[model samples]
Target: MSTVLEILHIARFGLAGVFLLGGGFFVLAGAIGVLRLPDFYTRLHAAGVTDTMGSTLILLGLMLIAGFTLLSVKLALVGLFLFLTSPTATHAVANAAHKAKLKPLLGTYRQTRKGDNEGGSQ
Candidate 1:
């Protein structure tokens, strides 16, 4: 019985480690996406998907490792807060970008001619 309990504990620890690593990778991917994406909307998608999920997963894993203590409860609460706010925040940002008339990157290759005076008076 004691051996079984120990094995279970070790397994939980391993699982938590895996979650942490995975979450970290997701965060890194989000950062890369923000850097590499062509436009604001796509970057918002990357950040919203990756940041929220990574934060939630990491918090959940930490809670499991914490084993029902106050810290675990706090971590769970933090995760809940993040789950609630991340998408809302992302949407707000995207909406603001849209309202500000930021253009999405499309496959249009219209090159400005010399003296075209784009974004200026004719």
Candidate 2:
């Protein structure tokens, strides 16, 4: 009985650690996307999607660690709130930007070398 309970404890912690690590990865990737993406809409999408997912994973980890407690309940509620709000906020901002005439970059761009136009007439 003792060994079984001990294993359960270790498993819970291991699962929590995995959730936390995954959350951290998503958050980091979101930050990178916000920095590296070309346009406002794309950046907003990256931030919005990752924010909800990352926060949910982190809160789930916290809930796992909290285990059948009020803290876990609170974390769940917070997660729900963020899950509902983040995308709504993102959409609202995107809509506003669109209404204000913010345009996204479209089409392909290729940089040609100065001497690379050999196929055409000089």
Candidate 3:
């Protein structure tokens, strides 16, 4: 019985480690996407996706490590909130950008300078 409990503990720790690593990778990808994507919309998408997923994974790992405490429940709630909000926020931003006439990067507009928010032409 003790051995079984030990194995379960080890399995939980290993799973948590994997979740953390995956979350870290998502964060790194988001950073790279911000640096490399052609335009604002794409970059926002990358950020939104990464933020939601990375936070969810991280919170899940933390919850696992936290066991059945109040802190664990709080972390789970936070994760749920993050999952709900990130994409909605992203979409709102994208819609605003569209209404504001921000143009996508294609062909001639391949690369715009950072901090340029002219919103293309009317």
Question: lDDT winner among the candidates?
Answer: 3
Instruction: List the candidates' TM-scores in order.
Output: 0.84, 0.85, 0.84
Q: List model 2 lDDT by residue over 1-122, tens digit each.
A: 99999999999999999999999889988989999876676789789647677898888898999999899888888888888888888889889888877766554313222333432222
- Cα displacement (Å) at residue 41, model 2: 1.3
Best by TM-score: 2
The order of the candidates by lDDT, greatest first, is 3, 2, 1
Model 3, 1-122: lDDT tens digits are 99999999999999999998889888888889988876787799789657777887888888888999999989988887877888788889889988887787554443455434543534
Report the Cα lDDT for residue 110, model 2: 32
Sorted on TM-score, highest at the top, how do the candidates line up? 2, 3, 1
C-alpha positional error of residue 92 in candidate 3 after TM-score superposition, expressed in Å = 1.2
Against the unseen true structure, what C-alpha lDDT does each candidate score? 0.76, 0.80, 0.80
Enumerate residue pairs that collide in model 1: none
The TM-score of candidate 3 is 0.84
Worst 10 residues of 2 by lDDT: 113-122
RMSD of each: 4.3, 7.2, 3.2
Q: Summarize candidate 1's per-residue lDDT along 4-26 as a digit string, tens digits.
A: 99999999999999988888888
